[model samples]
Target chain A: MTATLTRQAPQHAPDAAATLAASTPSWSRRAKNRAASAAVVAAVALTAVPLALVIWAAVERGSARLDLTLFTHSMRGVVGQGGGLLHALTGTLIITGATAIISIPLGLAAAIYLTEYAGGNKLAAITRRAVDIMVSIPSIVAGLAAYALFSLILGPGTRSGLAGAVALAMIMIPVVVRSSEEVLRLVPADLREAGLALGSPRWRVIRKIVLPTALPGLTAGAVLGVARVIGETAPLLLVAGFTDAMNYNLADGRMATLPVFIYTQWSSKGLDTAAYDQRAWAGALVLMAVVVVLQLAARALPPQIAKLRRNR
Target chain B: MMAAASAVALVLVGVLVFLAVNGGPAVTAGEGELPAHAKNFLALAGPLAFGSLWVAVIALALASLPAVGVALAATIYAPSPRFGRFLGAVLDLLAAVPSVVFGLWGLMVLAPAVVPGYEWAHAHLGWLPFFSGEPSVTGRTVLTAGMVVAVMILPIMAAICRESFALTPPALIEAAYALGATRWEMVRAAVLPVARSGIVAGGMLGLGRALGETMAVAMVLSATPSLISFNVISAENPSTIAAFIASTFPESTGAEVSALIGLGLVLFAISLVVSLVGRRIAKQGGLR
Candidate 1:
């Protein structure tokens, strides 16, 4: 069917070609085309300039303090320059892991129900709108929500990795649901039909056929969610609070994420304080690296996993 | 499955209810130890809300032109489709660059880079209220913060606009060409009409981000805690609701905390309405 459509596609093309050939291009047309091309070039250049400057500036300044200590040592006792981001890095990983644990299943389940079961019901429509609204909730607002909820339950001055994870989870869930729904919608209907035709129940078909096919996309979506919340500073500032020393506990004590660490370093530093600024730049670089790596993995991993599955 | 789906709805309602209940006092009784000269919570809120609006509007205006250009360059005016794809990827990467990093850049690089231009604006454009005041010594004015927010939203706006432009029917474009239209004319006549809804939706989404943006604005603007001024170059600039919440939440207690939360609720409501409207428009335009 696609072959016939492709073969017939060119049948109407000659009329356009004839029209193009008959109309001789005018000077004004050429000038407008030139102007348009210039506009596009200028736009591309303008957009590229800021990005280039950011990456360049990050690498140039961030690398000055990007030593081995940055990955290994914690900024516990060091006053000026010699400490590292080990504490913040570990806290970020733990908090992000907790967020993943909490959000992934909920997001996937929501996506599945929306795509497979809801079927244009009012409930699904409301859930979809809720998700859309959730997507736009500011990171700081999420922080406030988490803070209010946790402070009410745990009492005021409550700051922990768990609270931060919950805040991140709030932001991540909508992203995961939206992206997973898109991926699930892309799965062809015939596959579901085939499974159902074999006398499989709806749940079995979705579980056995649909979920696995969409697994790679789901993973990508989850990773995208992680990439988003991992850099969030405001929410973590409100929920996690800031800690100079390392604290591995999620529920008990304050934790330092890379973003908040950077924030404190810059904001709390005294005038003409170079070392603290250096540390902040290094932390920013590391945070950027983590996000870029996740994005790259998101793009690369799905195809490789598909290839491996095919081979197996 | 049903439980999980309902959780999203529950959280949405929960957040709003929590904010309303906790922040209710500030709205009704003005219970907080108000910022140094403020008479009430409403007085404090008035400036912050307007500041958020003013900066976001400025950011949207500054971002939209470059965003549209980049989107058009990537879709309609690219020398090659592959190059366009590359440009799209670059923009995506830019979007992934965290707000904190942008904040750091705004503080360290852009603030200084814009000093000379800011000085020129203050010196020459002083007749206008928006550019009237002396540029701040540190260059941490609302204008600088607005520019930083503009950079942050550019990628989002461009990506959305590019998707809509790319979806313009090939036949329509060809028809324009056949009618002896120039490339710019083709885009203006064929692409813009089809992409108009998406463009507006994208602009609103960018506006939402600009409004809610906290870390970058907090870092860039030397926030004036309780004052509102229209002077873009002034050191005495108003704080945005999100920035105010972030900066004050750590130190707030009781009524002050409630006031901060009240400000947050306002930010939440504004962003929610803007995003919902944007999403609806995008949906109507067949964009997911």
Candidate 2:
């Protein structure tokens, strides 16, 4: 009778508790999956907030002060309002241009040597490590190094746009080398072998075939380096002493850049100073625009150049 | 070609030598007023070094949580491939945003916005030493600077972790699913285990950045050049090495300059060691 009752109970409750047990695990799993998804969504949104806030604040505050004079006139003696970022803009262009001129060739050459000649040797490893270390050096330290180097050579308190450029170049070189090296490594080994088999010297092959193939990527890397250093404030703060007047010469005299201009405007102002604050916002906006445009160009150039080559 | 490569090595050596030579005086004999007599020479390096470590630690801890989540979202939880790609681009853009711009925003916008929250923390969580201070209205506390650093490093950490997560073996994930595992379970059993080392390396890399970040910290922190203090929310400025160099270098003369350089050298060494270790770990984790 006990055995018969047990068998009967199993048959009666098979679709009730048994089925519930089978579905409970899946229910909990589904709930866990939903919670994880929600957590990811929350994370993405939270991470995006700062970027959105910065862009929004820049646009809102910057647009109020945007005008022709703000771009055309120099802030020579303007105390609280009026004038523009003309000197700062010109100085930024000159300093950044000088930095690019200094960094690109040296960086490209280092990259070529690392990729073509070094070939896992101890020197190559050391060079690679040095580049890595350089990549992480603080911009302010780079500024100090440039300051010390220039000050010692040209007497103390010597501030020049050239010194600032040197400091920026110090920061940019490692970036250029690393990025260019990565691109160079991506060039197919088979292509190198074929070029060698065709009786071209190694240098000629690298110069003609590898470099041309890597030109777009190399440009991208150089542009990335420029983008990285163009907005640096601390190095410029130490090396390029602030100048309100327009200074075309990079070798002598203090000059101003957008970053430094913004910093001075913001920091030098006393409490409740609206005009300087407004100018700072406008300068920040312009700087952000420049950086964003360069970044877009960097991203777009490689693909466009590749397409052009394919068409040719 | 080899000469060019060696030039980079030479530059590295030159920088180190320059710092050592210039900063040597200050490091050996500290006798200068840091903030026009608020502190003496001996007080400079210790406080700044401690401040750097303190802020960087807090920033790293704060950033890692959201960074890991974002990486997971982009890699494993995105609604579609295109969405993931879009999210990746956004993160890249965030990474590309200038540090100074971040500083400006932190000082102008974020500082004011967080005043209430800081006050609330000070009021309610005062029992915790980290929150035990009278909150300032300006919001330029060490905690605020740390949050700014956290924001700055988030994209970097996220990008690295996302790349690692994307490289997780699909076969393992599929096997987990085949064993009747849920999506979260599949990630737990396969993805997390595979990407753990990469995530840690990425966090360390971010920490390296946080350690050396200058303008943002300089702008946001009130920067009291004092000895180490646990009071994070107070108006007492916590001076960091990079920030100290930047703010003081302009007006500093003589041994003061040397001392700032000394502080810079210390910062450089710390960041170098951190980045080297991070790079090694990242390389070992199979990231190029």
Candidate 3:
């Protein structure tokens, strides 16, 4: 490097020029640098291309039908041009709520066990591997497992919103456990030891000191877990039989969900194809909005809360 | 705690046992109007498995190239920290978008938009096996599904890559500059080498996702269980196993349900191999 710089130095006055080593970059090198920077920028642009395209398409196509009817009426009667995803929106809320109920408790318990109790034991080892495997299990396979279990229990063919919730819970469990485990591990051992030194029970120490400290993180993990599976289609399609009519009861009857609604509306479009397609697009738009909000909240809210606490 | 751990472990065992017990009959599944040369479960599963792996590999190639660039642009080439933050936000939103929406966009918009290119390739490069067949009139093909999966998995790959690149030691970067290296040269010496395992790990994560993705692929390729072809743009394209199950399981009755379960079993096995191998590599790379 020095040799090239010295060679490129000016030599007009040989006596005074002791190989002044400040060398100007070649034009080719500068051009290459500029081109490389541009290429990197272009690559980032390409990464953004899909998000831009998907949003643009959804907004342009679904905008006409994106109205309040999405939450007002079901798609039971109206067919030609006016129908809403009332059942779907409600179904999404119900099933996702149930999924959270089942998953958060189980996942939190497992995470607590792994981090607070289990210290490289056999059951912990098995659970860790299971969680890892669960993370990779395909959504459809998870759906099928729920399907098989339900079939074995409730006759040959049974589909319910509850079953769908079970399927989603299976998918959400690993996510919840993983994130919660990380948060739990971050709790200072000193706090737990301090609690023990104060003559408190282990469970009391955990519930009083540890859980409160980790509550914000746990909420973020659980909310993110819900967001992750809220738009799931394949699993719900298998377990939650779709219906256009309102079926509020998730115990036994079929339930509609946003993703499956979009799928059904688009694939089973009747004579008024444009109308069905429009409804599907509308459904997609709403689902995207909900998911985007949840995701942003989970990632964005925790830091701000921490900042506020620090300021206070 | 013990109960919770046992519950998870039980579910894992149960899924495997259920698939195994129910799926055994799939091997000799001959009750339906079996397509010629597809008398058994292995034959039935061949095309779907091939399609699954083939589409995933294509998506891996397509997403990884741009993902590396995104990482570089964010960490090294960003003109400002704000640019990197905005880029990260955009990617998080991209990941937040569900796969079904991607499917809708791919089928409704991307496929049609690219039909002309598919036709051009078919007409011009017909001698090549990939473009040898007639273009799909509706534009739902393996390649289209691959493109959709690529877009769906891109955010994950890029995020992982960015995280890996961010961990490169500052001293290493300064040394490259001290040696009078150009910015690109510094990256080549200090960044890429350190992040190579991470890049591979990120690619593998995306691969695992693409392999398992159902809705995007299903919504694009109208399932053709019997046909097997490599012509990516043709009307006839191999469909992934997940797509096959999603299409078939809903309406299946009698023995066909068992066959579908067998397909799920095959998928579970495939995913098991992929997940284990991927997790090992990712651990080596040391970034999620």
Q: On residues A1-312, what C-alpha lDDT tens digit does candidate 1 reach at each position? A: 986775564455658777756686788888888887887788788788988998888899889999999999988877876889999999999999999999999999999999999999888998998998898999999888888888789887789999999999989999999999988986778889999999999999999989888788888889989998899999999989998889999998899999999999898885548988989999999999999999887876567445734554
> Which prediction has more favorable DockQ, 2 or 3?
3
Model 2: per-residue Cα lDDT at residue B189: 95
Models ranked on DockQ: 1, 3, 2
Every model: Cα RMSD to truth: 3.3, 6.5, 4.3
Candidate 2, which segments miss by more than 4 Å at Cα? A1-24, A270-272, A304-312, B33-42
Worst 10 residues of 1 chain B by lDDT: B29-38
TM-scores for every predicted model = 0.94, 0.93, 0.93
What does the lDDT read for residue B119 in candidate 2?
91
Worst 10 residues of 2 chain A by lDDT: A6-15
How do the residues B180-227 of candidate 3 rate in per-residue lDDT, one tens digit apiece?
678887888999998888888788778888988999899988557666
Ranking by lDDT: 1, 2, 3
- Against the true structure, what is model 2's DockQ? 0.67
What tens digits encode model 2's per-residue C-alpha lDDT throughout B192-273? 8898888989998999999989999999988777757877788886789998888888888877777788788889989988
Query: Which candidate leads the pack in TM-score?
Result: 1
CA lDDT, candidate 2, residue B94: 84
Candidate 3 per-residue lDDT over residues A67-180, each given as its tens digit: 887679899987778889999999999999999999999999999999988999999999999999999889999898888888878866789999999999989999999999
Candidate 1, residue B233: the lDDT equals: 79
Best by DockQ: 1
* TM-score between candidate 2 chain A and the true chain A: 0.88
